[model samples]
Target: MKAIFLVPKDYKLTGGMYMPINHYVDYFNRNGMIVDEIIELPYHKDNTCKGISERLHSKLSEEKYNIVGFTLNICYMMLRDFQLHKNSNCDCTCFLVDSMSLNMDSVIRNESIGKEYIEHILKFFLYELKEKYCLRNCNKIVYVSSVDKQYVLKRFNRDILGDVFVVPNGIDLPNEVSDKLVRNENDIPTLGTLTGFSQETLNNNLYPFLYSIFPQIIKEFPDIRFVIAGRGASVEVEEKLSHLDNVDYIGEVEDLHDFYDKVDIVVTTVKKDCGLINRVLEAWAYRRLNIGFSKNFAAFEYAENGVHYLSADNEGEFVSAVEYAIKYPDKARIIRDNGYDLVKNKYSWGKSGEVFLDIIENK
Candidate 1:
């Protein structure tokens, strides 16, 4: 089957959207589908909305693709896609990717009021707003997480444009984690974290605080190292962290193999956002334990306190999780073994690919 994917030109910073699009493009191609990539630039130098509109207008059933897939995240992109779906003369199935419930979930609301508002607005929209417009436009809808799937199904009999499907984000796991005995030989208890925190999100937090604390961690486990992998660290984030002798800032790594190789544990000390951090999956794929902050992280089902992830609810808990991950080396290896298996079984791209292909083929 021929499939053409329409994705936005999201820079690598938007980790959630970026990785899933990349994964499907490559994965579907591998699994007997002829896949084509078409990106809608985000107001780049060469292209304005007019140019993108004209571009979308031109590429109809003219291509070899038998299927038309509009893969994007956020409400803003929906404006363009709604028109694209409205305009197409193609016979191809219109597949929509909305991994999370975008309509009713409040991005800004805290727990108590957020739930009250979320439940009301979510119920209302699944009945009113989304069902009337968005969900009705496609032949199939794909969500990257199960929370997203359950929220939509239990709330609305709203027939999503496509057959409603869930293909949770996947990992490309290695065959085997090295036995615990060999991990120390390579690198002992090194923890790594990826930060795309530009001036926008962390005006002055994440990296600065992390750098300061690393020295204390170094004092205790002098052999322990830290790898900082990401693209949008502010010039200030780069400048301050550069002086820290222990932190290794490897900028914009295309493939995660080397970064995952050098680390024993991974960290995601995020102060905000949820619905499956890509780095957590990366750690799982590599058979490494993860440590993440616990606020708004309720969306993840697998991130238990000690089993799959070591979570820290506050700064004290953060320090303690780090200390625990560093101290008990055997526990870390066991975490790696369990995590690797979990990802391979439940979250590998192969699993996602198999399910999604069946959805697309209507099998």
Candidate 2:
């Protein structure tokens, strides 16, 4: 048996799509499979679709693989070429990185964007057609969230329901969360939130929460520090938050290990989109208090409100959760401990690898 992962050029060994794909490679090698190669296909840098497609087609013809998995936004030509040359023994699978339809809806509804309505509608339709064709043709379609799997099933009338599957994101948990505990030893409790907000648009998911909810929380707890991770903070967003004295804007962290280590609690803001929340899982693995809405915990079946982690629906609730966590240290520790235990038991890479192997092998 053999399997190969066809990944995009931007895939990294850090979080996101790379984590699960890395686990899948381990699974294939451990379970008597000879295919441990991951082919990185370049993304469209030249803005010319035809040139990229030609290169992908040429690359596909060179590989002799049994099982090939496609990541997000894979070139149409690569898929078409694989379909053309696919043999009886070979299999094709796709991992829905995120809900494409839902993302398209977000773009269409975004007032800040400048694209014409008719243009967006046409692009939406074409994307749907391409996704449907890929899903119908693939041997298996893996979704990071059950919500996305159900959405795809409802959107497409094809008989691909049985072929679709859900494989929640996995993480590598440490034996103990000493770094978090050490951070908690500090006098001031720190809250961290990661986002990629740019100056060009307000379409970033972190905009609403940062603009609306964070200010209120800062007022309520003047002493508490708010750490902003990742790049793309708009000038407007920065100006809006500049008056706050306790905010720290640490831009573009290479790895979240050090970031998670320093933060006492993790704050996940409510966004327009819903899927696998990697930050929540990372916080759990690090044994930190993760506070977010109920939707953020949708992918984690074991997550319990105020137990495995805290949940907040509105600005008031978000403020209160932070207040409670800061004022009552014992309860916050309990929540963090429970989250750590939950991830240790259920979300390990070994278990995720086994599930992926079973799916790909059709066991």
Candidate 3:
């Protein structure tokens, strides 16, 4: 079998949509399907719609491929173009990283009304049209999580023409779990989290925790420290962090191993329920005790509340969870071990690849 992947021009090997797409390409090549080409479409550049359509059509028509895969996050226009100039015998599959409708809805509701908000509203309707087109035209739709799959189905009224499959995101596990330092009774405990620090993330995930939850946690464990690492900190974000005495705001971490090693507990502050939290998986892979809201963990159905990791919903619960982890280090270690085992056994690129390959071959 021969295949070709259509990806955004700005796609990288590690972040964003590239993670799953890279795994899928590797899996297909190893399993007798030759990935002959990975065509990078100039979606981000200022090209006319007709120009992009022509370029996509020309590239796709250059070779005869059994399968053509698309990363549907930002390439909705390409999908529409592909449908218009598709080969009758070739099959098409779309890989959705998350529900664009849900994400856009959240952004519009959260962001204040302004020029940016108007732009989002326009993009939201545009995405709606493209999403429906892809759903009605493609041969198969692949989702990173079941939560996203269900949301897309309900939003589109289950009017999809293609078969939908849930292929959860996987992690690249560390070679060995890092050794955590033994805490003396007088030593201060540390809590850590990482984010891109976008305006949306700051408002929805980090700022809420910093303002409402962290104060209560600080009241109980005054000696506890919070370590935050990620890029894109605006002046306002910097000012906000400066006011908090307990916060150690490291600008950006070059390697996550060091971040995981320094913290006693990993907290995922993402409030969105649409996609799988990579931090949760990373914490488990590094054998660190993770505390996150139950809703954030909803995408991974296999992860249990008390067995795998701690779950806290609101400020009071979150503060209490942090307090418990700090007080009873031994019990926290058990949860860390359990989470490590779950990730080791259930989450991997190979597993996700196998499922994707099965769907492609069987179809």
Provide C-alpha RMSD values for all models, in order: 6.4, 4.1, 2.8
Name the regions of candidate 2 deviating beyond 4 angstroms: 13-15, 44-65, 75-78, 84-86, 106-123, 159-162, 179-188, 198-202, 231-244, 254-257, 270-272
TM-scores for all candidates: the values are 0.68, 0.82, 0.89
User: Residue 189 CA error for candidate 1 (Å)?
Assistant: 3.4
**Candidate No. with top TM-score:** 3
Best by lDDT: 3
Residues 1-363, model 3: lDDT tens digits: 577677777677447577777887888999998887786766543555567556555655665455444555444654554454266546677776677766677678767888888998998897777778778777688777888788888888666986888888889988876757234433456888988877778878888888888888888878888988887898888888988969988877888876887787888877665778888888888888888888778888888887888899888898887767766767777888888889888899899888888877786
Weakest ten-residue segment in model 3 by summed lDDT: 179-188
| TM-score, prediction 3 | 0.89
- lDDT (10s digit) by residue, model 2, range 1-363: 566666777688445767777777777787876664676665433345455445444554666445554554563334554452255535666776666765565557754445565676776786676677667567677777887777778777564634887788788875555545323332457888776665323444565666778778878877778887776666776776676567777777876675776688888864535478887888888888898877778778777898888898889998888877766777788888999889889888788777777887763
lDDT tens per residue, model 1, 230-331: 777768767877887777888777866667766667777654342455667777777777776663234456656677677765556656766766567677
> What is candidate 2's local distance difference test score?
0.69
Give the candidate order by descending lDDT: 3, 2, 1
- Alpha-carbon shift of residue 64 in model 2 (angstroms): 8.1
